[model samples]
Target: MNVSEPDSSFALVREFILLGFSCEWKIQILLFLLFTTTYALTITGNGAIVCALWCDQRLHIPMYIFLGSFSFLEICYVSSTVPKMLVNFLSDKTISFAGCFLQFYFFFSLGTSECFLLAIMAFDRYLAICCPLHYPNIMTGHLCTKMVITCWVCGFLWFLIPIVLISRMPFCGPNIIDHVVCDPGPLFALVCASAPTIQLLCYTLSSLVIFGNFLFILGSYTLVLLAVLSMPSAIGRHKAFSTCGSHLAVVSLFYGSLMVMYVSPGLGHSARIQKVTTSFYAMVTPLFNPLIYSLRNKEIKAALRKVLGSFNII
Candidate 1:
């Protein structure tokens, strides 16, 4: 695996061949159609949520603000990889070295931001459910905006050092990436040197982002659950559960797949498993977010109706 000696200069790698799937033409066609439909629905679903949040004045509160921001993030997140994957299925799979790293940076950055945002969203729900009296004063418009901005900034900056370190490591011939996306594991495997330090850094950051946010979310929801259970009225309990249910489901879908892929990177999983797991979070989760949030929550559903109705009339 070592491509360079201690004193040797790093070799320049111009491009990478993405061996997306080693399947037949028919299988590729089937997968292409399946992913195309999934991507279309994902965009439409997440886009509707974003539009609904914008057009409806009723959803202008802190909760919906976070939800809208997350929906928008989902659109960007899925866009970072799915388009290239679809193209790879049909045509040349070659991606320039810069293009690969750019994809790597954005994909990981956006995903990191998602982890932060999800944690923040869970905290928002906790405040709303557990501290109803102080919720409005605590989560003001200004604070919500600040939190959203912080998430984006921190997310984009999270993997800067690791990406730089890994990018500098020389890549040898047979410059091929096994996975659909320019993921860290596959990218690491391509490295010409035994970059233990860089590999550790990447995995550490991934673990911290995934596990740290997950723990924060878990703690927030635990308190929320306790508060909800103690509510005096049965109707109050049901309402509280209903509001938190969608978020919990989304969190489950997101963090569950992430932990499996990242927490133990390149452990026992094969390339196919990695692709499937990554697709679940990258493609499937985005498609489900709007549905999960909209179906379970009356406000989101109503907002969608309002947005769609206006469109219909026009």
Candidate 2:
């Protein structure tokens, strides 16, 4: 499709009406309240995690560095979609095409970045667990920085492909996205008639990236588990398992729900199911990450305590 040419023959949609969770005022109000609480908790939880890692000298390792990056990304990820949806629920249920695209851009960027970041985190764990003596030299500050930069660069590049493809498609008919926020799935569905081949190709390419990262992460964790099992001390085994458990749980939740929502029979999936699964990865997972890491891990909790205690605020 020639995206550069503005075809006046085709109808142009000025804005997209987001079909939020519900049309009923009461339900909308309830959803607003519920999501408001989730958003607040997500911010607080992730913010605390980031601050704890930043301030604590004990968390100067590559693992915590990745955790801090994860927290920050989760904040941006949730902020990109949730805040706008909240406002729409209370006021106008409309978003400009530009706004929708921008939302998609940030969401896609962060989501893709997370896949790489998680893999990097798993690799970090593998190095730390499998080669404990060389962990420091291997995952040095410079190398960690490079890995983080690569995560962001790869994420933005991967996301650009879909955005470019979607931009080329004409959106002339109904502009109602049947979800609380703008996402690639609904967006592609909206323009399916204009460029089915492009949509299919983009979707297939994205699926490959997602599944490929999942397999890589799984393989890293498999090696990690094997290494952990070889340790004779029960305490050592527990500590090794504890380090990656939070990340593993999060990966399962994020990628599991994502696969269920997108990789399944798209025609058979109900809108309600998609909305629920979307909420899992998009909204719920962010909230759970900090909770899982902070509540389950001793290092983060001790760091949080130390930071809070320094101010006599704990």
Candidate 3:
């Protein structure tokens, strides 16, 4: 039945029941343990990256700054949803209207910022690799800071209108979101009215952020690839590929799942596929990002070791 305020003329849902993983109690416990461990590791790994970058003077350059910002974003991204998810695993899976929208906003906004930052990072690498002589003059410290700020501002603003519109829409009873998070799909399904305009707007915004940034990253890396290939020294080529490799891996992990979820939803995929894909991009990617960067990057490893040694933890 519809659950609206007594004073309201129309019926509306005040809280949403997030239908998180339909499993037995034992499975829920196991999943909670798994997610809790994952969340802890994700936070620790990304936090370490930020600290390493902040403490190391050698890493105070544009590339490392971008890395630090991205790592911080990962921490925020995972935190925005994981804590509530962990709570729901052992407790009630219900979320108030305001809380649900807040989660939805932060999660998508942070994700959008990540996409922009990734593309910006690719551009930075492209400039550094392809135009080494002018790289210093081009990517200045002031400019790098500006770009990072722009990524965050744009990301946060991009979905504001769409989310506001969606939140204002009437949500009738049986307010059950099928997936784990307050995703647009499940929320859209719960809307009492046929909100085609709002749905289209959300899809458009998501597509623009996901596809637009993906294409930009692709183009930047394509130029980087050509520049690396044309280098006379094999060492130079290997170094170029090595620097770009981690970024590419992250891009693949993030965009692959995103395309499956947003860009091509009509691929006859199942809800399980959707959940798994979301889990990969949302939680798994953040956990793996620090490992991918630190393992592949000698500088990052050195910095991390330095940080650890200073604390006598290594």
Candidate 4:
């Protein structure tokens, strides 16, 4: 196939226009307000979690440490997509080719990092529950720091390959991105029309990263569930289940929407469905994660009280 240059021909457009939820003025205003409110709450909720974990020594455990990292990642993840989308709703929807690629780069990096971080959290739980005697020695402070670093490094490394592959393709024309954010799927569709080889490479690489990380998370959680069930004491089992349950809920929400958005058959799914599912992970899930753990966990509740009491003294 003759791949047309975006500059030379209309085949690959240099800039793609993102068609936000509605073309109507009233709906756009409403969406802008709604999204703004959600964004604010997400920031506050996640920020509180991070702050409480840092200030309170009691929350310095392995699980809380991981939760803090996850909260921070959620803030990054939501910020990358929501602000841009909100801006598009209020103003011009067109984004330059380079701009779109950058958006995908950050979004993909944070997203892939979340996947690995969740898996690491599961592993932490496994050791804490199944190997309590060795948990402290195994998941030491240095090891936790290294694990967090590895999550970020591995995530960026995995997504960078596809971003590079996608960037090399020339855009000719027709620069409208079908979805809210600069998603890889719609981005690849444009590439397919112009450069089939690059498109295939991007698709394969993205699929591998998404699927590979999800399977690892699933497998880790499976063993965790088994270990939880094996505990003799009822209280032990309940505590173990409670600890893993919140994480499991988050893992399911993150991977479920991701799989639906990327892995499922795209034949019958509408753009609206795509937008909604994308929001689940990009907007709603981030907000839910901090709330879920804080609400369910006793230590976090106590920390929040202490933090609040300290603030009152000032």
For model 2, residues 1-314, the per-residue Cα lDDT tens digits are 65697667668877898887866899889989999999999999999889999998878878889999999999999998889878987998899999988888888788889989999999999999999998998999889989999999988888687787687677876889898778777787777366666667766767877898899999999999999999999999998888789889999988988788666645667778877777778899999999999999988999988888987988
- Which stretches of model 3 miss by more than 4 angstroms? 1-9
Tens-digit lDDT track for model 1 on 183-294? Answer: 8888888877788888888889999999999999999999999998899999999988988898999999999999999998658799999989998998999999999999
Q: TM-score of each candidate?
A: 0.95, 0.94, 0.96, 0.91
How many residue pairs of model 1 clash at the backbone? Answer: 1
| lDDT (CA) per prediction | 0.92, 0.86, 0.91, 0.83
Candidate 2 regions exceeding 4 Å error are 1-9, 265-267
Q: With candidate 2 superimposed using the best TM-score fit, by how many Å does residue 290's alpha carbon deviate from the native?
A: 0.5
| Per-residue lDDT of model 4, residues 1-314, tens digit only | 99865454446467889886866898889989988999999998899888889999877878888899989988998998899899998899988888888889999888888888988998888788878898999998888989999999988887687688778775554667789999876776665356666556665766777788778767877888888788789999998888889988988888888878666644557878988888778998898888899999999888877877888932
Checking candidate 3 for backbone clashes, the offending pairs are: none
Ordered by TM-score, highest first, the candidates read 3, 1, 2, 4
The C-alpha local distance difference test score for the whole of candidate 2 amounts to 0.86
Please give the clash total of every predicted structure, in order. Answer: 1, 0, 0, 9
Please give the RMSD to the true structure for each candidate, in Å: 3.3, 2.7, 3.1, 3.2
Q: TM-score of the candidate numbered 4?
A: 0.91
lDDT of 4: 0.83
Ranking by lDDT: 1, 3, 2, 4
Error of 1 at 9 (Å): 9.2
